[model samples]
Target: MQKQRKLVILGDSAFAEVAYECFTHDSDYEVVGFSVESAHLKRDELFGLPVVPFEDLEKHFQPGEVDFYAALVYSQLNRLRTRLYQEAKSRGYRAASYVSTRAFVWHNVQLGEHCFIFEDNTVQPFVRIGDNVVLWSGNHIGHHSTVEDHCFVASHAVISGFCTVGRSSFLGVNVALANNISIGADNWIGPGLTISADTEPGQLFKGESPAASKVSTKRFFRLKED
Candidate 1:
């Protein structure tokens, strides 16, 4: 087992905050700071810890001594967490992962660097998860599913057997991936989607729209204006 020391949060999201709490409670990690990308960042503090810029996090916490976990949550937008995780790793920052005590992971399951498997996730046998993944709460990873590098699988997603989720893919909440499927790289799967076939690289998949409510446009406008 690696000796846990001072840890750093790599983003300013609620996920980062949750990781801070989880690590402090369950592990030997002492969270030293937070980090943000050069662009699209605000402020300089998270819960009183200095918000170190992703580019210059090392100035605040050295890589050799301090471990860092990217705390970005995946969304409809493409691969932000994946991009930042790779950048941090390239900068020589050690990526961290959390397998919650409530989670059930098989002893032989292989989880690579920089992954966070949250509460109640059931990781079946022979699963291979690559670097920088977030398996949020209540996910079911069926046997032999390979989750590639930089993928973010949000809460309550179901990845069935023999599936291959490619690099930088984002699976939104309640998504159900069919067995023996291959999700290509950079794909953004919207929430409530069900995929049954191989997705092409960079594909954005969405669910079928529900039939419009019987309410007329006038009713819709009135509801919006209210």
Candidate 2:
């Protein structure tokens, strides 16, 4: 086996833990430590590794020696992740991308820095994924689609062929983008919404919740209890 690359994950949250598990088990990355901002540092240790302040992380782990992965959620339409990724790049630290071994990514697919593609994701040929993008489990990225920088696509989201998801966009679970559609920057797409046309920038879209029927299943089936 090849030697594993030394890595530092910049977060101490659930996302960071997930990153550690994926990188450790499936990839050639060895997680050395976790980090957060000094003000947000809750504990000194995580997963038996030292949790350091991100501000001075370079002092402890040299940029040339260790790579960095910004493990963050889409708290601010993925803008926070983008900012942190840029910060790591400015510090001369190499950003790492985690593509799960279970994911089916085409050879022609292009992925950028700090991307996290989870298991069961099917990325088709000619797909272009930009920096700091997160494709959660079971997502289907169609052929020739472009997901721009800092976008977060949740589980089971289906992006059709030739679609363009703009920068810092957040796609909720089961969200479906139709063919040739364009999702604009900073757009927040709620779960189960289908986008068939181009969306304006910084839009908030929400799907209606399902209402319960008045008729019960037992009544509808006309089944008698023994």
lDDT, candidate 1, 174-225, per-residue tens: 9898999998776777788888888776666655632222443223223222
TM-score of 1: 0.83
Model 2 worst lDDT window (10 residues): 209-218
Alpha-carbon deviation at 40 in model 1, angstroms: 4.6
Q: How close is every model to the real structure, measured as TM-score? A: 0.83, 0.90
- Candidate 1, which ten residues in sequence have the lowest lDDT sum? 217-226
Candidate 1 — which residues are off by over 4 angstroms? 1-3, 38-41, 75-78, 209-226
Q: Best candidate per lDDT, number?
A: 2
User: What lDDT is reached at residue 135 by model 2?
Assistant: 96
Kindly give the number of clashing pairs for every candidate: 0, 0
Q: What is the Cα-based lDDT of residue 170 in candidate 1?
A: 81
lDDT of 2 by residue, 1-226 (tens): 2547999999989999999999888889899998898999999999999999989898789988999999999875565677788898899999999999899999989998889999999999999999889999999999999999889999999999999998878889999989999987767787898888897766677646322234432333342431
